[model samples]
Target chain A: LDATAVADAEARQAGLVKPAGALGVLESLSIQLAGIARTCPPAVPGAPAVAVFAGDHGVLAQGVTPWPKDITAVMVEVFRNGGAAINVLSRACGASVTVVDIAVDGDVAEGVGTGAEVLSRKVRRGTADLAKGAAMTRDEALAGLAVGIEIANRLVDGGADLLLTGDMGIGNTTPSAALIAAFTGTDADLVTGRGTGIDDETLNRKTEIVAAAVARTAGVDDAINLLAEVGGLEHAGIAGLVLGGAARGVPVLLDGVIAGSAALVAQRLAPASIDYCIAGHRSVESGHIVALQQLGLRPLVDLDLRLGEGTGAALSVPLVQAAARVLNEMATLESVMAGPDA
Target chain B: LDATAVADAEARQAGLVKPAGALGVLESLSIQLAGIARTCPPAVPGAPAVAVFAGDHGVLAQGVTPWPKDITAVMVEVFRNGGAAINVLSRACGASVTVVDIAVDGDVAEGVGTGAEVLSRKVRRGTADLAKGAAMTRDEALAGLAVGIEIANRLVDGGADLLLTGDMGIGNTTPSAALIAAFTGTDADLVTGRGTGIDDETLNRKTEIVAAAVARTAGVDDAINLLAEVGGLEHAGIAGLVLGGAARGVPVLLDGVIAGSAALVAQRLAPASIDYCIAGHRSVESGHIVALQQLGLRPLVDLDLRLGEGTGAALSVPLVQAAARVLNEMATLESVMAGPDA
Candidate 1:
């Protein structure tokens, strides 16, 4: 991001028709966008694309959530068929959806479906149970990250100015909680929550699982090793998307806990990658708050959304556009004073 | 609102692919839309229109804000010329802007400008200084409300499913703080804030002015009389928009402190009016919080927005549409199970 452009945008926001600081976060957001674009007023982000990284969580065997592990593959199909929440929300926000099969347990064909594009980029079918052992080898985690980075590069090269991270992995929040707790050094109990409406017994067990996983990875400061030890493949992929988007200077809108945990990984890999990231919404998942706090990202929307198929991030597309539009389309106070139509 | 439809929408929400209640406020918002439309799945709110009621406050003579009194008229022109924050945001959200000159002290023509439609509905040049006397006569307040109701009806009749409340009145927050303090029984210091921008001395004086005005209307239970005593014409007009949108079963998205205070008046006039009101954003103004609390409304966006030209409301159009689209477009879990493309 260009500091000169940021300064220019701040000056521009000051002179806009509204009172100084009246637009609040939006004023700062526009400046950030400008800085990212290396311009006085950032161009309105065009062709937003949400990449839903689908994988299967090995931790589901521990009963972290009641949902079946097969539900993950079913959701990838659901996403590809335009039958999911992210599809509906992306349509509403005029964004495209791309479903990437990173490591789902079930078979998913690679091609553009009737709804969203489906990419077969699976590094593995599934990971080893994180509660018992490493979720994946470091190489597998790096492979997942490479897939995400490739997808993000493809989307950006194909004219996507904004990238949104979406994830579909059953019981993935278990690993998300573990990842957030490990990264933030927060108590596992505080970072874990009921995923997909789990019972109290399951939630407690999930907390224990998260605590044990974080404790196992306590001395591992390497982001990839930590991700491989406890994070799901989708988390690795989503982190790669964040890093890829940041490398390309495209803003990545992060969804719920899955994306938040992934963002923490991305931030550890490259501290400045957090600069190009936007927290789309505060998820109901408790760990999401910790992850966002650690990343220093304030969500653009807070609808108590816990759904992680990028629906929350898709909903914020218009807001991100409006932030840039205000900078580009709105007349300065001096211009307004010059003439009504100025 | 239809109770049966609300129940049906809730059931439908549960059947969606995502976890139950994962969508959070969006789930309730969709159910509310269903109730408003009297259907299980409400049609996506289409053709959102913002009615920016422009007025002048006699309380500008009270040294409440640093902006010139003529800023009200200048902003109205800015809105009409599509150079205002509201216009830029509305355009981004696929909404239309309509500037209504309900009580501008300066002359404003009635016609469709190159940007927004300017409606000539001025009831009077301006209001009397609320610090000294009634802001308007009872009949004038009623007339201002009539203008608002008429505009809402016209927009809804023209196929607008959503009506957004906007206001352009220099020093309007002085009266807004007074109105909120009156209705919510909050302290003047608690409700009062820097409208555009004010120093310590002006803020203290503004708080005193609000305290004095609310004291004058301490026992006034009549909503209309209360509006006449302390509310600006734009407030009355915006209240009318709320009432009219409610009466017609169209959702009304409300902007900053001015719209918040107006919605309070609308609620007092007809408590049911709040059922159709959606707080667009929590304004930076302290009084907006008090007013939203009194109305029992949760804001969709809280970007610290205080520029009330329907900019905040307009920014929520995509979110509102997404809420409804999820209900209408998302395939039920059972349907997804029926087939991959179901």
Candidate 2:
């Protein structure tokens, strides 16, 4: 069952009364589901879960962003304390967000207690400084993938039909771009953007560094090899989660450039993994467009958003739900005895 | 005791949080309440009643819009039936919207099946074609204002602490621009803008017509006189609602261009009415900016929005609540005892 067939069957469901094309993109989404499930009226009982992957990059030591590196921990504290933007948006969207300390150096228990669930799977207290050394070893990359798969399986077993992947890593975009360039066969210039609003001089330097990193591992074919050479642990984890969603047939909403690049790596690992992926929105990051186009994904909203705390995805969740509701709820023209012109 | 003091107290309370300026514009809003209520702790109770006034203008018969005049009634049906954008946004914001049919030449009871409580006080089937005659007589304008005040009083009695004024009148922007020009001493050409996506040629004609109407009513002292000469009944009603909110110390969120012009009229009627008014967002209309500036009211959101179904105000409702919540909920620096740098 391909994407087109999935869309068609979802639209042809008896309970959905509107004409097949009435709701535009929403109708197409309904049909896409039918083709995927190989059943009319694809059930989308949403058990929404957001995975907030927290990590640190050694690259932060090089003064890429103006904010202190500790602000990341402070923000993680804020997230834990339910004061962050993601917490507000998640609350508005009615999704429970779990903060996963994938590579933040301390015990998750030591931090300000997040009101939500906390998952601690620290992979070596963060990646090696990507500028000087590989971010992680191939073995560590595989471990990250295993962790992501485990999380996804847990969410599904807990009755989550939809997964939202978010990341909170200072200076992770450099590694994210490197991974995107490696996977998409695009050069660093096209796949690198100003992360955290760097100056022109720093942007040029960052682009050159990512290009050098991508060039070092041009022949890497395996997902584990790619992850070991140029991926943050959180990136690897999210990629694995995307693949996990595909295996379980649950929809995954990707947040920001980091999650987008991770999805690209996941698609390379499992080509059919694209079926479960939905681009939430294009971030202000220049690389996000390149990665989204590579994956053939279209965003639901575009508000010149650059904030990466999954706020854009959370705002877009309503639109996605609206699309599904329109497919399932709108009265058909035939039922209303109204002509298309009416 | 007064609106400005209330706004000021709210702002001071908001500023005393753990981080003095963390919430951005929301901080200013808390202060706005201090000024409005003339007190230290401004009351922000949730008595959210949205008044969606529906009407039609005889000017619409001039084919100024590509959409038919009947769309005015159909869209009222859409709003009543919960299919319009306002319905979606109001539902998201948890505000109940009441549809008031004012001077629209249609069966007022036809679309009342939707859950919206319909208030029909027809000033007339519609306003006179502004191109050839005054929109309404002085008696009719006063009658509209009375109807609006009556509705506001009823809403207040029913426990509404906030009034949201929205309009659904087709081709009413001409009258709105004329009213603004009459009140603001601005030339109609500068204040008039393309309404409902009109073409450049139609816009020019609309602008000329509005300028003439403004010229005809230059020396009006009372807002009711100006409204009678140039405003639609819905416009007069909204103006009266703004005054009612001010007199009763409830805040009113003004929607789009027509609502902005109405607020301007309300300001002229009661200069202190500015205390009760909060510009929801700057609509794409050129006159709205002038009206907002003249009234010294700053808008919360600026999305270049022109969809005038109270969607902008509804979107800002959460922001307003957030502003009030920050004032009321966030821990103070003394309480948290954290670094003042926070």
Candidate 3:
């Protein structure tokens, strides 16, 4: 973002009809939007879309989450049919959703097969159980990230001015925690949260598995290598989405902990890539807060939400749009005031 | 409100193809809307509007806010010409703006005369300076409240699903702070804030004036008496608007400190009236948060805003409508789920 453009936008905002900065964060948001667009009034983010990355976490075999792995494929099917939460929310937000089966346990061609209903980008059925060994090879991680980058390019090229990150994999939050703790060097138990509301025993085991994964995954020099060791395919994909968005200078709205973890790695890959990211909402997960703090980003909405799949991200679309609109549309102070600035 | 309707909404929300409470405050907001509409799936709130109460504060002469009292009339003219901040934002939110001249110092009939340009509801020229004597007689306050109630009745009867509270008054934040501190027994410095970015000297004087007014206004016992003592005519009107919204079961989104202070008085007038109230944003004014806390209402949006005239409230109309749409249109978990609880 150009500093002079941001400064110009801020000066313009102060001159708007209302008391200076009375619109609050909306004013700041508009200024940022202006800076990003490099104009006093940038184009409103048009044709927003949420891309949900689906993949199974092999850690589910460790009794990490009570959900059946089959639930993952079924939920993807639900998203495909527009019967899922993200589907409903995206509609409410006036946005579209695309479900990408990068590493789901099911076959897409035999399942909800193609023509935008589902993108068949499966790198593998699933990764090995991380509690037993390395989750996936570094090459597999690179492939998943590449898949995400390709999808990001496709979505933006297809006319999505705003991209939202969504995730659909049971027990994915476990790896999200693992990734966060590994990158931030935070404690496992402190950062771990119950994925899909698991009971005491499951949560304890999930935390233990996360700790072991972090211990095994520590000292990975590259962000992608860390993803290969302890992160889910969706994490690599979302990280790639951030990279692509930054590379294209498009804004990406991040969902909860999963997206936050990916953002941490994306920040490492390209330090300035975090600039394109906006934390959509704060989730109930402890690690989510840690990730946001480390990134120095504030979530627009704090709804105590734990559901993933870009539901939180989709909800904030109106806010972001309003920010731009307020800047673009409101009458300036000079236009309204009769005399000089004294 | 119907308890059964709220229960039904909550149950439906839980099964709305998302994790239980994943939508967070939106889920709860939907349930509340359902209860207000007295149905399981309430009607989507459509066509919102802001009725901005324009008045002048006698506190202007006491050296509180720096802006001239004439600015109120000038801004009202701006609103009439549809060139004000409120007008621009209301249009952006897909809502109309109605400027009601309840106690503006200027003559509306002569100034912004004729047509539906401005609603003539002026109770008097303006209230008396608060630091010296009572702002208005009890009867005048009742009359102002009555005007607000009639306006509210007209709005909802005329097909506005949501009515937002707006105000146009230069130096009104002083009375707002006085009203809040009077009602809540908060200290002067604790509740007073620099309205419109006043200098330190003015803020200190404003704080002292607020303290004196609260002392004089103490033991009024009745809500109307408190209004008569230190409240602006717009304050009484906004309180009446809250009462009117409650009587009609219409949701009223409140602006910044002025609306917050008015809501404090409204909640006192009718304890259950606060149910119809929603705080739009947290203002920079310390009194706004104090009032929200006193009323036990959480603001939907918190941006450090001090501008009045329903700007914050109008920005939140999009959010309010989205919440309703989510409840009415989202698919149920049973519709998407493959099998049973397992």
Separately for all candidates shown, the number of backbone clashes (residues 3 or more apart, or on different chains) is 0, 34, 2
User: At residue A142, what lDDT does model 1 achieve?
Assistant: 97
Q: Which candidate has the top score in lDDT?
A: 1
lDDT per residue (tens digit) for residues A1-342 in model 1: 899999999999989988899888888889989988889789898899999999998888888888888899888877888888998888887788999999899899988865699999989998889999999999999999999999999999899999999988888889899999989999999999987889899999999998998999978999999999999999999999999999999999999999999999999999999899988999888889889989999999999888889988999988899899989998888988788443
Tell me which of candidates 1 and 2 scores higher on TM-score.
Answer: 1
For candidate 3, the per-residue lDDT at B108 reads 77
Which clashing pairs does model 3 show?
A: A15-A333, B15-B333
* Candidate No. with top DockQ: 1
Quantify all predictions' global Cα lDDT against the true fold.
0.90, 0.73, 0.83
Two-chain DockQ for each candidate model: 0.90, 0.09, 0.58
Q: Which 10 consecutive residues of model 1 chain B have the lowest summed lDDT? A: B333-342
Off by over 4 Å in 1: A340-342, B340-342
Q: Score candidate 1 by TM-score against the native.
A: 0.98
Question: Which window of 10 residues has the lowest lDDT sum in candidate 2 chain B?
Answer: B15-24
Model 3 misplaced regions, further than 4 Å: A109-116, A339-342, B109-117, B338-342
| Full ranking by TM-score | 1, 3, 2
